[model samples]
Target: MKNILKYMSLAFVGGIIFASCEKSRPVVYTGENFVAFEDTLLSIPESSAKEDANGETQAIPSIATIRINRGSGDISKDLVVSYSVKAKYVTTDTLGNEVILGDVPEGNFYLSSPGAVTIKAGEGFAFITVTVVDNDQTDGNKKLTFTIESTSDASFTIGYPGPDKKAKSMVLYIEDDDCPLDINDFVGTLKVEDVAIVSTPLEHSYLVTSTQVSPNSISILGLFDPVTRYPSPTPCPAPVVLVFNTATKDVIFSPTTQTAYYRSGGCPATTNPRVVYPDPAVPNKFNTCQKLFTLNYYVRNPSASGPFDFVYSTVSKP
Candidate 1:
């Protein structure tokens, strides 16, 4: 009986030994103990294109940019995006010409803080866009809607036709009197620079110079009035878009805004198209509808190239 018990004990020991001798598998740190990769994107800033009442048409100008990125834990990883434009006031046209959202990385990339764009005078109208180049297209609103209203007097303004294809610009505000609100309050005679006729190009252009008012501010410029239709019905059911008026050389905001319309193509030729108040003390940021110093340009129609200054700027008063 003793021998039999000893053999049983040996067998148990051998079994335990065999189990311990087997190869150890690798250990995995996971779940609550696991390290996590970064998630994509933080928040985007207030990118709404707000316009002050200046320039050809009210346009928001911006040169600054915001850097979108992942959290610190995921900063080392690569990121890509898909883009779309979300305009609260109106719908955006499908012109791929609005592509700065796509080509941003190519320009320059140093991690800058929240970027901003300032529309001095001739500078307004950027591709107010958002994109998720690396992610799915359904991430957010991809299309932007510009505010559009149907008025008899809708239009855009073009700058002086120049020697080079490049030209500075501003959008002309078409008066919209039919708009229910008081469009005339902002339509007082504007203070502008002196002018003479320059017909070397034979177009009988005006040689206009400029002036400016700092801290210029603007209130909403148009509203619709339909007092007669019915008390039950609302006025201006939708947004409106601007149109070009070659006949008047001015963009008429609406048919009712006939008298308040400004003439087109008559800004004084200034050596510095961007400077508004010709003050050496203020150095930069001249606030004028017409360019006070210098103006910048981007070619809209590459195929339709010529010695034409497509867009220009000049002084304007509210």
Candidate 2:
């Protein structure tokens, strides 16, 4: 009986092994061949201005490359893909409401050969190029949409899974590069409004004169003197300068270690306050179009103990 039991266990183990070794049917790709856009949304940066050899500043046009991809198909034969462009595209917002984004004007962009790209033999991808025209006028950012209309080879589908998929269309955002930094705009008289105060309260509204110190920097001559509780001299003994970032529109105090006086409780007499962004969530930036400065910073006396004061200020051009 013991020998019969041992043989039965061995037979069961062999049966399990045989079942595991048996191969299942292979997964066959029954879907048809298709072509689709590599990306649904794309951005083209604003054209930049460069000095030519003749000493003339010229605008360099921005180019955008749109890619088409082929899936599950023999790429040995050349395939011609045709696309259509529209001024606007219809999309849904977060609330599921339909939104139309067709802001691009007719003269803002030039498409090469009316949206046709050829996937060469033995290649699975092709590209179409669009040249963004720089009008040198600040008209805001624009958008254009392109849709895969048809193909020279009818055997391949318009989009990967189906023509109705998101890959069948692409949206191009052409950013504005027309706003060039002019240092003169930051010059003249400006008003500094203290929106939020920390430690000692400064003036509610103060007038300061700004002079262009450099191409991208300016000196504010009449900044409030924290020590004296009054406006500083015309030529400030401790110069207060603000530097502008041309690309990002960010403003920062050049000499970040400037000293100021605070007389509030738990604070020392003097403090070296550095310029910093008030909130990490929102950007500390200068609006060139509106000529506004939104800034946030802290004034802390290192010699003091406990909490320090946070200052929120806005400088605007009158």
lDDT of 1 by residue, 1-318 (tens): 000000000000000011234369432222121111112222322122455656344322222222211111111222221122122111224585342332112113111112222112221121212221221111122212121112111221111123431112111111111111122322333332222112221111122211211122222111111112112111212211212222222322222112111112333221211101112332222322231322111111123333122222232343
Quote each prediction's TM-score: 0.19, 0.42
Candidate that scores best on lDDT: 2
List candidate 2 segments past 4 Å from native: 1-30, 48-59, 88-113, 162-164, 180-318
Q: After superposition, how far is residue 224 of candidate 2 from its true place, in Å?
A: 29
Candidate lDDT values, in order: 0.21, 0.60
lDDT of 1 at 43: 34
**For model 2, how does the per-residue alpha-carbon lDDT over 171-284 read when each residue is reduced to its tens digit?**
887776556567777789888776445456654677777899999888765555333444433222334677888666777777654443333323332234322223455456
Q: Give the TM-score of candidate 2.
A: 0.42
**Candidate 1: TM-score?**
0.19
